[model samples]
Target: MQQESYSQDANISPNNYQLSTPTKEKKQNKTNQSTTIQSPNNNDFYSPKNVNPWKTPKSLLKSNQKQTTPDHSQQASPYGDRYIPLNVSRNLFNKQIQPFEIEEENAYEELLSENVLEIDENKHSSILNFNKQKPEKLQTNKQLENPKRKIDTLPIKVLDAPGLDDDFYQDILHWGKNNLIAIGLQRSVYLYSVDTSKVFQLTQRFNNQVNQIQYTSLQWNANGQILAMGSYDGQLKLWDYNKNAYTGTMNMSSKRISTISWANSNIFAYGSKDKTIHICDIRVPTYSVFQLHGHTQEVCGVTFDGNELQLASGGNDNRVFIWQLRGGNTYADSQYVSWEIKSHKAAIRALAWNPNSSGILATGGGNQDKTIKIHSSLTNTEINSVNCDSQVCKLRFSKIINELVSTHGYEKNQICLWQYPTMKKIHQLEGHSERVLYLSASPDESTILTGSGDETLKFWKIFPSQISNNMSSLLTMCEIR
Candidate 1:
């Protein structure tokens, strides 16, 4: 009745509203509209169960906590079960997550919970061994070799020589192989024994002569039985210290015999101021066997090689000559002069042949030059040279090592030890107060004797005594005079 009254009052059109819809149908349509309004469009909405598993779980949780409901909360309350917050769902969908961290944590936990296998130590000891090996130590040659130390700076023995000459060109002191020292004091030759510490005047008979000749040079033969004394009068006096007798005296030259060097037990050579070199044999006590003339000034230095096969001579004429031993008249006109060197600017006096090397010679220059030159006589070439800084008075090769010991004069009256081939100076000794004029080594070459104008004879231990058996045998076989 109420529906008919409202239709008549509004001038109801019965054709348009043919039949009234049911109340149940109208309520169903109203519920559908409310559901559509509460839920968002399908394109913008997402379900929690269908969310990407790769997204960071912490971001999704934070977005969900930050999300707020709209002011129409009561309207959407009935369909809240099917609805999801747009911010939370969109953040979880848009974000990227690192899967490795989660996987690593899972793997570590799995490893900690895993069960490890066990084995009996005695049953598999060899296969499960963990011992380390210890290596053996090695020894070096330096550790096994002899213990050698540096030489002392002071002389082991010092002696007084009241009348020793200070002349640079003359050699007046020599050490014989028998351990005796033959030293000339002014006009007399004295013999000093190393063992007994005794001195004897060998030229006692010459004390009576009015015109006593001064000793210029002294050398002992290879046998160590005869001592040859050179004088300013050109006399080559021979003496035997063991017998205390004068063996003989030969007139070798007209001027002073400045230096003498023995070649063998019976043969020797001497240089004189007459600028000549003479080789003599003991059998002919009055004459020389071979004569050599090359120097224009006084011959001050002469030495035979290691094997006594060749002779090297240095002269005041600044010349050096190497001669080969040959018998006169053996060949019709054969020359004994093998080579000559004029490398020195001043007089050349100091000369020494390397006892260990063949054809190796060391020559030193005088005050004007002040240099040491090494030469190879085999190749006829100058090997090396060094400035001595002072006058080179004498040079001698060391027997225990391949070295050269030199004495200096003028300024810096000192002795120097040089390493051979390289010509490097090793040590310098300064005990002399004046010019050092003489140098002679002991029989073993472990010690050297030096004489200076200060009237003192000093002994220095220059070489080591730890000599090899081969070197000892060689020294015994060769004279080294």
Candidate 2:
């Protein structure tokens, strides 16, 4: 037989060679073995001739993986790692978990303080578990428990104050340190006892005088023993209420004395319609110690600072002046006039000095101006101002808090409580049928009394009481006894 095309090596065995013609399957196996030999790796079935030149190595690898891996598209999870729809999540959460029970809308808004939902994906179905959490308390509700809460909007007490003057330019009401309130009603001055709730006349009505003497202003000494009354007939009268005796009466001005203030228990100051301020020592009833001339019209208001070193005066000329209390006879010296403010468009009838702050003064304008201005006597400039939208009749500062209470006239006839520096209106009280013209605070500063032209006096509890534990216990002990 013809020798087969075998290796011409001496190591070849004749039994391993196919001596006859190769079968069809054997021929195909030879072709496949020849294609595999073209590649560098004998285990790699992909050869250069079998793979397309345009296809990358990554494509060939993916084709091989697809042929080996089984398809699981028909058996996939219903949930996914991505976010579920809001509606579907809500339904699932409602069915799986119970939410917190909130009593208020604010509490509901603060509910679910944390995202406590935890998912377990090891099981066939997704399970969401919610943990319980405490909702935070509302700030507004906690603030209501404060000791210094908001004041009541209504008055605690009311009384008829008939014959009270309706003038917006006069200060006819004052509360003394002895718990006594003095109010000028036309030609008479009456004292009301806060403890006894009794009313007594301080001055009798005089019918024999040529011109009827109507009481214009009232003020009390620091000791609350002597009260100073100004009259329309230009007279200044002092009375010792404890003794029920008249101290003295003198003609301090030729015009009506519209206002009066005490620097101490002895040194006194009064303003008149003659456009002058008279500062005199009560010890000497003969003459005034100093005469201040600044305003061109009636001097309707006058106040002394807490230290008795400066005096503030306002008038119908729309001018406010701060005078230094030096040994001087007149403020015309120019050096004695510490500050002069003409920021008001109408007459200024209200003036007050901050009891806690020296050189800080507050002045209120009349009907046409309807504004309150705060001034610094030390800097000789206006510190702040607020438009009241109504006639500012009077102003009183709280001794315990940094608050200012103002009485209004002409339309609304309301009383407003304002926070100092910021000048924010804290509360507004309305009860008077006519213009609210007079304002005064109790000795403890826990209450304020407002006198209106409608002949009504309303008492409002404006500040919290500052009572010590010992005092409260003593009061309780006395009540029990």
Candidate 3:
């Protein structure tokens, strides 16, 4: 009856409703019972009351993705549509799978924790028990600041030494302990007083021309009372400084004296172009007291050891000879050649004896060799050698520091300082435009005088003696603190 009543409407049709048989009604009731079964409050089941028909489907949402399209104005002029697939799958996968981390320790922190843990624990324990150990005010141990010992290589004073002969083999400059400097200029020898800063002519040529009577060597006695000068005319002259007068003259058998070194108060040794080393006693200037004959070429350099019993000589024959003195007044027969060094490849002109180490001797070679060799007298063996990279003109050992100084001749014209025994170069003094021919150190071991072939004399404060006082004061202040 209800289906016939609903079918009477124009919109309702009898075909839309089926007559309810007993089995159909029971099946329909069973379907209604299953549909009416309540589900638990979970989002997995789709309920008609909660479902929105107006919402977009998941498939439609996937199809309509928010794409980042390039602007048409920035595209190429052609109008063909191009779709480029993003190649960021690996990056996306990596970002999605990567695990999150908090923080990590660096290598230094790990090393400290592994090795210094015990020390750190001990330090912490000490700090915790510090109050119990001492009740005094907290204080830190002050560090002593040592003043740096610096070499001021700049010339403190530069003076024009006119008419100075540019001879590498000649020793024409000497600085005395009395703050006096005697330099040979042409045929005249000039004396300079460092205290008064005054220079005066000590001697001049009497008959010979300036070129023929050039002074080749100058030396001061240990007491600074007398000065000895050797001339190219094969003559050696003595001057009394206090008296300011020429005392005596000795003739060398037509041989030019290249270098001179004082052995004692009354005795001095000189090297000659005749390949001979002669020792002269001022009391007897008529003849040499002793003569050393080892070199086969011109003897260019000579030095007396600290004890004055050993003499080192270098010559143009690339040889170095060490002679032993008889300690007292003796003739040529008493002195003998102790050793001969044949290590140099060229002429050997520079020689020096370490004042601190009595047995150590240093010799430098000429332009062809450019090498400096150190020999031990006791061992009679070569101890060390250094390649100067230039002609070595002169070598001097420091009295206060365990170091050595050298002047170069060709190419470099530099003065270099080196550590003793090790021979490590400490500093290089550079200023002279020409080859440095002569070098002298002050008696106080604080200043150095250099003479170059450019006819100039430069005074350099190479060592600071006041640094010792500053260092001592710093140590005392630290101790007091």
Candidate 1 segments exceeding 4 Å error? 1-148, 205-208, 285-287, 327-334, 469-481
lDDT of 2 by residue, 14-111 (tens): 22321223345644443333221122222123333332222344545867554333232532221233546799978886886768896755543344
What clash pairs does model 3 have? Answer: none
**After superposition, which runs of candidate 3 have C-alpha atoms over 4 Å from their true positions?**
1-147, 206-212, 285-287, 327-335, 466-481
* Model 1, span 235-267: residue lDDT tens: 888877678677787885899999999988789
Score residue 460 of candidate 3 by CA lDDT. Answer: 89
Angstrom error at residue 279, model 1: 0.9
Enumerate clash totals for all models, in the order shown.
Answer: 0, 0, 0
The CA lDDT of each predicted structure is 0.79, 0.78, 0.78
What is the number of residue pairs that collide in model 3? 0
Provide the lDDT at 97 for model 3.
73
Q: Quote each prediction's TM-score.
A: 0.67, 0.67, 0.65
Candidate 3 local distance difference test against the native: 0.78
